[model samples]
Target: MVEQLSRREGDCFLLTPNRSMSWKGNIRIWLAAFILSMLISTGMLLVGAWPVLPFAGLELTALAAGFYYTSRKCQKREVLTFSQELIRLEKGLTHKEKEWELPRQYTRVWQDVPRHPWTPPKLHLQFRGEEISLAPFLNIDDTEELVAILEKKGLRVEKRRRPEKLWF
Candidate 1:
């Protein structure tokens, strides 16, 4: 999701991934799967297959962990505030884990075109020879929208084509 926040300080852009399922919906789905798996595992236990119970528990645990990680990832975001001469970036999941303030004139926006058509292009902010990826979870359209916003703000965008060679 790309949202523009109205701010007196500067133009603010909030970048977050779009998640189709709400937490409540996710919980309900996981609960249903849990109940079904437990019922089958318990039925196996009664049939003298005790090992199925532990394995079921392990499988459910793994499923719960994956769900939790995905939920947390959805909470991640990047807030970019472009002032007249400076750019502020606040990135985190729920809280500001990383914040950067750099001179807008010196910062350059970079877009890397991937060789494969299935893969989405990458966007990054280059400052002082170091590059920071910008909203990696954004899809192709949203990525292009971000680039448009950056260009509108007068940030120079450099496009790069990724190499096609596969090397270990």
Candidate 2:
């Protein structure tokens, strides 16, 4: 479950990426590999084929590693705080915080970019001749929601349309 919760003071938005057990995503891939590995392992055991045991074990290990990495990388939490002059974002695993002071009358834009279902949405920040990224672990809808919240705080969003038929 992914959610954007506001702080008690309403000065910030806390984005938390909750643990998801829904096998709708990469779990399917891992399960398939695990099943295949189990089948091979069983076949090897039944036929007295000891060499195949290592191969099956290695395949199962690979699948477990993949699942662990994917789950960890997908989890995230970000806190977007707004002040009268600047917007601060605390993001990443370390929750390393960064701040961007708004200009006196700046243009805010939301660019419509193409995104894959498995990939997280990217936040592009431009201020004081510097470009930084915030909320690098959010999905597209969450990105758009954050953008809208920022717009209410008086920032411009520039968006580019995503082309149709993304797959080549």
Give the top-scoring candidate (lDDT).
Answer: 1
The total of clashing pairs for model 1 equals 0
Worst 10 residues of 1 by lDDT: 159-168
lDDT of 1 by residue, 113-149 (tens): 8877777688988889888888998988888898888
How big is the positional error of residue 106 in model 1, measured in Å on the Cα after superposition?
Answer: 2.3
| Candidate 2 TM-score, C-alpha based | 0.66
**Candidate 2 Cα deviation (angstroms), residue 7:** 3.8
Q: Runs in model 2 with CA error above 4 Å?
A: 1-10, 16-19, 22-43, 94-112, 115-122, 160-168
Predictions in order: lDDT: 0.90, 0.65
Candidate 1 residue pairs in clash (backbone atoms < 3 Å): none
